[model samples]
Target: MITIKVPCSSANIGPGFDVVGLSLSIWLTLQVNIVTTTTTTDTTPPPHTLNCNITYEGEGASHVPLAADANLITRTALYVLKCHGQRTFPRTTHVHIVNPIPLGRGLGSSGAAVVAGVLLANSVSKLGLSKDRMMDYCLMIERHPDNVMAAMMGGFVGSYLRELDPADMERKEIPLAEVLPEPAGGINTGLRPPEPPLGIGHYIKFGWAKEVKAVAIIPDFEVSTATAREVLPEVYSKKDMACLSPITGTSGIFNLQRLAVLTTALTRSPPDAELIFQAMQDKVHQPYRKHLIPGLPEILASVTPQSHPGLLGICLSGAGPTILALATHNFEHIAEMIMARFKQEGITCRYELLEPAYEGAQVIES
Candidate 1:
């Protein structure tokens, strides 16, 4: 039996939309057992018969699928195996999942599931793929590097997808249907799925101050990432851009400047609450997403280092209904202020105080 553990993640980090992420303490764990039951003393390779069972508990237990073809983890594992020329799972396989991360709450639930799947395949097949190579498989499924990379590598992380050559770009454009196809009539052995472009993602881990911890003020609701993205405008006017920019600059330049500063600012020993407060301000996505999340503007505008002591910075966690506030002390006080604002908006919320999961994903066998 093998046990795989993966951490949940929060992406965007205020100004760095889709560019930065931080792994939190919550986890998604998978316990897998693969047994061989062969009565015949056959020397040749056994037929690829599918016998897989999955059981899930925690967060989305009522709604999450258990079938191998429908579950994200198993489907992703099968996708990786298919790429390496293997068709089916071992004759007898069982996977038990315990998930704590909330789904559709911008907390990288899907990303963790995908990472767990890749690790599962690597262990069961005895594939000696390096972490970097396993990341390639993850990118193919999740398509976003911020959440997945942070979940896989841990700590405070920044990542980007590399520019592919013309041929590889074409390969990159392969539709999701083709990449993770449903095995309608058992596993398809016809045309092979396109493999991911080599080194398609590159990332670096950033330093985080030991004093800083996160307070996740999560509302009792779900905000789909797709819905949050659709509300954003295709272009920004100069006035709209100027709201976030210190100078008369475009929105892109505004976020870039803060992102660069925020990355290093977080590494400082004591941490400058004032500097981090200004750096965490965003113009890219938050402004448009306020409608999706009630009391968002009030929370960001009212909660400040000056108004509340011990508060470093705060922003929407992912495509959130969950707000993340970074702080050093007075964690409960910080959470109360945000929760009060949310209550005024007729929304009930719960908060979690979490530290960064520095170790990231791990696999253990017994």
Candidate 2:
């Protein structure tokens, strides 16, 4: 049997929404084995027949459909095998899955499933699929390459979609070309353990700064990707863009030179109090998205960088609800302060500090 473990991910940090993503240490494991017989009693139709069995564990276990053909991971794995010229199955492949990533929480649970499928097929079939090729198929399946890139690459990945050449397709005559990223970005990331207690009335914050503690704040709420996309406006005015000048720069030329420097410092070196505070400025996207998340701006305003002594920058995880903060080594003190600040704002939320996962997905024999 081939066993693979895939990490969970978070996408879209402030201005880089749908573009930036980070893979976390959290993981889901899949075990697949080839079953040569359909019946244990030796009453099978033929010697070359195949049968399959599936088992699931952890989060989403109750929700995952039992139909193997309809299961996303199973279907994708089967598809990968077929694409590699294995049109027929002589033996059934039994699959067992263990998952922990939260679904539909902007945590990239679906991305993990897609990644596992691709990896499982390649390993079981001995296809020798390169990481790039696997990522290509996964990106195609995800409909968003950012999350997949982070999942595959296992760090902070920044990616943006660009139009593909229609002429290339015209020459080959293919329809529905894929959406992909020109490049990707990421850094080793993590979440604080002692897994924070889940309850209402907790404090939450989001955005950038020096010396930041990334508390991955999540709520007991479900928000669909479609719903979140629908809430975004189609256009913004010149005046509206003008409002971001101070945060962007004095000239507001759209060059967040200081902000980029801050990000570079944190990734190049280990995240510290100075780096977190330095990275805490967002002149873009946050204003536009504030309407979607009401408590965000208030949280940002409430957490004074140096005044808090240990807090640095704060930013949202993927979509809505999950907030991450960058902080100093003295996170406990700042965490308490953060709770107090959010309470005063009348915004109750929960948080967990996360670390970056340096390794991507992997499969091991059992």
Candidate 3:
């Protein structure tokens, strides 16, 4: 039996906007039991001929798919196996997944699922791949470094996709549908999937203040990432990119300046509440996403260092119906205030105070 545990993550992190992420304490765990059958008679079935059984519980269990071909975790595992020239599980595999991370609320549920899948493939096939190598497979599926990188590496992290060579660039463009296919029967064994280019992503882990904790103010609704992104403008005006000019900067430079400061600001011993509160402000995604999340603007404006002393900063978590607030103390007060603002908009919410998970993903065999 092999056990894999992957942590949930919060991406964007205010001004970082698809560039930074923090791994949280919540987790998605996968327990695998591969049964090996001894051949006694001619009628004994071969390992590849047996099917995988998947069972899921917690969080999205009510709606999550159980079939190996359809589940994201299983599909991802199959993609890796196919890319490595191993077409199927070597034995009858039983995988049971336990997830506590909320799905589609910008909490990196999908990213965690993808990480678990890659780990599953590595363990089952005895790939002996390094964490970096496993990350290559993960990046191929998620296509973004922010959420997936943090979930895999743990702690606070900043990541970027590498510029591939022309030949590999074409390979990178392969459609996601082809990457993780859902055939009516099972994974397509006829055509080999495009293997991820080696070293497709590079990342650095950042330091996080031990005192600073995350308060997740999650609403009782889902905001798909696609819908949140649809509201953003493709191009920015001079005003949006302007910084330190006579006129005020709006978006681009606004995020850049803050993001530069925030990466280090969070590592200081005595965190600066006021500085962090300002640093966490965004001009990239959150402002545009306000319309999708009711009371978003109000909560960001009303909750502050002056109003809530222990509060350091607050921002929309990922694409968000969940608001993440960084604070030192007075967690309940901060949560209540944010929840009250959401309540005014006729939205109900719950809160969780989480610490960063220092260790990324873990695997155990017995």
Candidate 4:
């Protein structure tokens, strides 16, 4: 039996888009066992038989597939086993899942599942695979590393999808290909790699400033990642790329200034309160996504540097609906302000104060 505990995460982080993510304290737990159901007590055949039973406890418990074949954890575990050269997929396996992290809510529940599967595979097989290797498989599964990177490594992570040498790969991002399965001739036959080299490199580039608190201004309504993605235009216009004129002596480029301040907030040790608010502004996804979240404009309008003291920045978390904010103090006030605005506009929502999870997924039992 093996148990995996993976922290939930938030991706995008304003201008970082798919490149940045931060892990929160919330978690998803998974327990997997290789055993047979009581109905088939016979130790009959040479073939190892396994029965699968899955249970969910929170969040998407009622909706996530209970059947092993349809479950994300089960499928991912099977794939990892196959990649590790398992002659046959497990026919009798038991899975018990507890998901506190909300699903399809820009809270990284999928990333948690991916990390859970890979880590479960590593533990059950006693394959001393490193976290870096696990992240590789997770990246292959997601095609992006923002959520998985934070879930796997924790802290404030920044990543890029590109090629790099082994050493550089290790430093720039978690190496997914750390352990490759090879057959008789030593030529690897299993684990079909991604068609394109979607190698992602990431690390904890910075930390939050001031006595920071991450607040999730989550709404009652849900927004599917697919819908949010579909709403975005496929291309950008010249105006979108246009930077501020050189005339202002560096004042013209809006997002660049924001990115700089955001980076400073992260890189600097004690986070700079001066930079937090500006850092949270975005030019990429929010403009197009505002329509999906009810009362977003009102919520933004309600809070400002003058109106809400200590409030850093507030913006979309990953896609839509949930608006994550940063603040040095007055958490309850911020929450109340956001909640009041939503209520007045007739938008139902909830808020959660989150802290950065400094560590990634771990094995609680083996």
Each model's lDDT: 0.88, 0.59, 0.88, 0.71
Ordered by TM-score, highest first, the candidates read 3, 1, 4, 2
**Estimated TM-score per prediction?**
0.93, 0.74, 0.94, 0.83
Clashes of each: 0, 45, 0, 12
How many angstroms is residue 81 displaced in model 2 relative to the true structure, after the best TM-score fit? 2.6
Backbone-clash count (model 4): 12
What is the lDDT, from 0 to 100, of the residue 162 in candidate 3?
A: 88
User: Per-residue CA lDDT of candidate 1, range 103-203, in tens?
Assistant: 88889999999999999889889989888999999999888899999999999999999999998977887788787776575566323877888898999
Worst ten-residue run, lDDT, model 2?
Answer: 187-196
Instruction: Encode model 3's per-residue lDDT on 214-289: one tens digit a residue.
Output: 9999899999988988998899776665456455433447888899999999999799998999999888888899
lDDT of 2 by residue, 163-263 (tens): 44554334222211212111111100111101111110111112222333356655545456666667666785554443344565554423244445554
Return the number of clashes found in candidate 3: 0
Over 4 Å off, model 4: 33-50, 87-92, 164-200, 245-253, 267-270
TM-score for candidate 1: 0.93
Which runs in model 2 stand beyond 4 Å of their true positions? 36-52, 87-90, 160-213, 239-259, 268-280, 283-285, 288-294, 332-351
TM-score of 4: 0.83
